[model samples]
Target: MKSVILSSVLPLATVITAVVGIAGAASAAEPDKQFFQSAEGKWIGPGEIVAGKYKGTKFNCSFTGSTPDGKVGMSLDGGCRVGMFTQQMSAKIERKGREGYKGSFMGGATGSGLDIIGGNVVDARKVVFTINRNQLRGVMQARIPDDNSMTVTIAVRVDDQLVPVIGMSLKRVDAVEVGSIAPN
Candidate 1:
């Protein structure tokens, strides 16, 4: 029963993890400490399955992102909801990655989840990762327009071209101390 649940939710977990992890791990000579720090904290977002067998299925996610004390990547732990179904998702990525570098994770079963085959930092605000699992391959791109928002896109290789599969828009969840007990 647990295996059944995991198998069913694996795809979604891969999508979310790839997007969040690759956003901070893709390298351009060195890891950007500022960029990694900026990605830490809470995030909430909505995502849609733009194409594939699950086309039109939409989900919302909330995550807490954290950077290792001085490592070169990010880790995210969170859950996503599709109607009443919820799945727990998490990813950990760390590397002094180079172009064509297989930004590998030390955890997880050898062939279970997606592997980051390669990645590149497009600019100060965007990074793209090549993701693969056996013959199935794809690209996940993360673009941060500001410290508070992020947009992620995932596309799969289809014959000769990449086809969009998932898209998500996420925003930082700022802590608000709106109410405090008065000391009388």
Candidate 2:
């Protein structure tokens, strides 16, 4: 009689603990979804590649697209010229899980594409991602300083060391609605 009672209570306690754990995990993911939802709309402004092979070259980047809560979709495009060399990239990012992304980046017009994986949101205002292929590894970070500005940094792994390669800043561009405009 004593052994049967003890066994019955142990299983009931274990089931209760598991249910609570699942509820806690579901609640924890709500904040991440809210964080991504806040960064909606288009951000357009000027920036520069302050490191790597393109240091001191000024350029403009435009970021457009908004991810609905619990979804992911964003793109980035930057172009600039230094002497006879031109640099540019076009990439699309999609949300992964509760706080991560995955995308592909195409460097320049005729360049081979790189795979973007392991993207994560470190906080409410920062997003990071990694790219790896063969012997090359790279990390990219996008941070928001305020409601109107963003900063991007890119780094690559070389000789077992991670080195800064690019830095960029952009400002949020508000969209204009047709119905909101009045005849001048």
Candidate 3:
């Protein structure tokens, strides 16, 4: 009886292990995966006012470090003029999502505590975010096809239409490789 019992238990354990392994692999390959696995890095670019009333001016922007909780944070620094006045400002980007993200910005010349809403499109080699209504959009596309460098683009609305405002090229300074360790 002991021998027979041992034989049955061993086969059951093998079947269980195989099932678990298959489930783990399936989860890892699932589509519609949110949050990027390669977005943890530093990105710098220049922004321009291409639309609306302010159509010409350059601003510097940087995205540094991604939160462990799946949020990308960034900062913007630059100056521009609006109708006989020059101003300098700083802004921060908090989070990005399918519908959009929420963040706040401030400036020394006119507007302070301004809110930003945008949505991001992320793939293996590119990330793009669009802020509607404000007519502003940001894009980060790979430069060397498979390398770590990327080209960034910013577009804004002018006269109720969308137009490219600024463009910059950036390189990824760091990234974290992610993988599944267990079955979901």
Candidate 4:
């Protein structure tokens, strides 16, 4: 019985393994804070909206990533440009309490953007955040494929599945690495 219960909870547990909390046993083996620190520096790259009505829209972006001193989170601030139009891009995620992560993007769900209500560090190379606005819910993943590149994808819940809506690929323009990345 215990085995069956543990099996059923493992999936959710995998993601909620204390990304919202103080650094604990769940993340002891993973350098969650180091991951954020390593992600610092300026990034530049291109991306496309691969799905939804905005599909095929292409844009370029530049951002600066930083981690608060003595903290286990990161803040990404920058903007994207589509033709002559420019959109400011910003996100901040910090570990809180003894549970999971919390932060915002563009702005909070109350302003013009979505709220990052919860999240977890999946591994050394990937972290997943849950975003919500009104009735629309989504998941954002930031994956660092190498020291010089990061990729971000936002997928919204469609019916019973999550569909990719926005993708960003960024390269470390200020660091010494040949790579590309994405934004939320």
Candidate 5:
């Protein structure tokens, strides 16, 4: 009965392989893959004060680049009330699930202490982050119905309870870059 046993085993193996292959493909098609892909590049926009005393000033900021190690470099110019400020910052960002990312930011704000840690959130067209109880929120919506351009909205929280301190809008910013970590 060796031939009979061999036939049964072969069919079972074929079925198992097919099932595994389909499962692998489905995982690869997950929505998070899109975020990981679209998140590669540079994004720049203007910062505005919406809710606080500094409600009308405009500032510039950018996410310079993203590394394979999940870190992103950020720079901010202006957007302060008391003094002119420029900042050089770096942070690691990762997709948590369904339009969410969590990471830590550490950098210097002009004329102030240089170390800070916070978490960030991102979706297909929006990004939000917080530093030391202060929040920076940005939303990107499509510009043209068929084009890739997006309108971006940015807001900040001024207090410990995460209140909205300021807000601004920007348009046509690029996406963030993402990739696998390189060998150190």
Candidate 6:
């Protein structure tokens, strides 16, 4: 009688364990969708280059992007006019994974550019982009503190060390539809 009871209890335990494991996996997947949605939008603000030839100079910066279903892409541009030191810079990004991207950065004045080798969005709030090629190695990070505000930091390698080059504060003035096409 005791053996019969033990056999029945063991099967019930196995069933319970399987059900619980499946439920846990489903819950684990919820954050991936939430994080993807939370990071899509258009953000704009003024920023300053902190550690280069243009240190202390200010520029108007704007970033626009969509990261839906783990697909990410964004475009960033900045321009500054400081009496004989005007400049424009731009970059384009496309996602490589849930938190990864590939892009390029270009300076309009010098026409110099670098390849963006890797990038990632973390916890739907913080973002990072990195570049490493030839003489250029740098990282750019941005964080959205709230629905309305964001901060950015850019660092470049100089003399074998990473140096901060741009720091920015941004505001979200608009939201973008992820898959809309413009009528041409």
lDDT of 3 at 145: 34
The candidate, 1 or 4, that scores higher on TM-score is 4
Question: How badly does each model clash, as a count of residue pairs?
Answer: 0, 0, 5, 12, 9, 1
- All candidates: TM-score: 0.75, 0.62, 0.43, 0.78, 0.42, 0.59
Pitting candidate 3 against candidate 6, the one with the higher TM-score is: 6
Reference-based TM-score, model 6: 0.59
Worst 10 residues of 5 by lDDT: 15-24
Query: Which stretch of 10 consecutive residues in model 3 shows the poorest summed lDDT?
Result: 15-24
Give the per-residue Cα lDDT of candidate 1 at 119.
72
Instruction: Quote the RMSD, in angstroms, for model 6.
Output: 20.7
Residue 179 in candidate 6, Cα distance off native in Å: 13
How would you encode candidate 3's per-residue C-alpha lDDT over 1-184 as one tens digit per residue?
A: 2222112211111111111111111243221122233333444444444443444544444444233333344444333333454444444444443344344444211232234454333444444443322222332222223334455444444466545544444444444432421111
Superposed by TM-score, candidate 4 places the C-alpha of residue 10 at a distance from the truth, in angstroms, of: 31
Answer with 1 or 6, whichever has the higher TM-score. Answer: 1
> In model 6, where is the ten-residue run with the lowest total lDDT?
15-24
Kindly report the root-mean-square deviation of model 2 from the true structure over all alpha carbons: 18.5
TM-score of 4: 0.78
Angstrom error of the Cα, residue 82, model 5: value is: 10
State in Å the error of residue 38, model 3. Answer: 2.1
Tens digit per residue, CA lDDT, model 5, 1-184: 2222112211111111111111012253343333333333343455444444445545554443332433222222212121366544344344444444333333222212211233232333333333331223322111211122223332223344444333323232444212432212
The most accurate candidate by TM-score is 4
Clashing pairs in 1: none
lDDT by residue for model 6 (42-98), tens = 555676656544557665644443432333454444433334554454455555544
Question: Candidate 4 residues 31-80, lDDT tens each?
Answer: 67545655677777887767755568777877777666656766777776
CA shift of 61, model 6, Å:
2.1
Cα lDDT tens digits for candidate 1, 1-184: 2232233234434333433433343344243444445566677889887776677878898877766654566677777777999876666665554434344322333535566666765655676777665566777777778767888787778899998777888877758321131212
Q: How does residue 129 of candidate 1 score in lDDT? A: 73
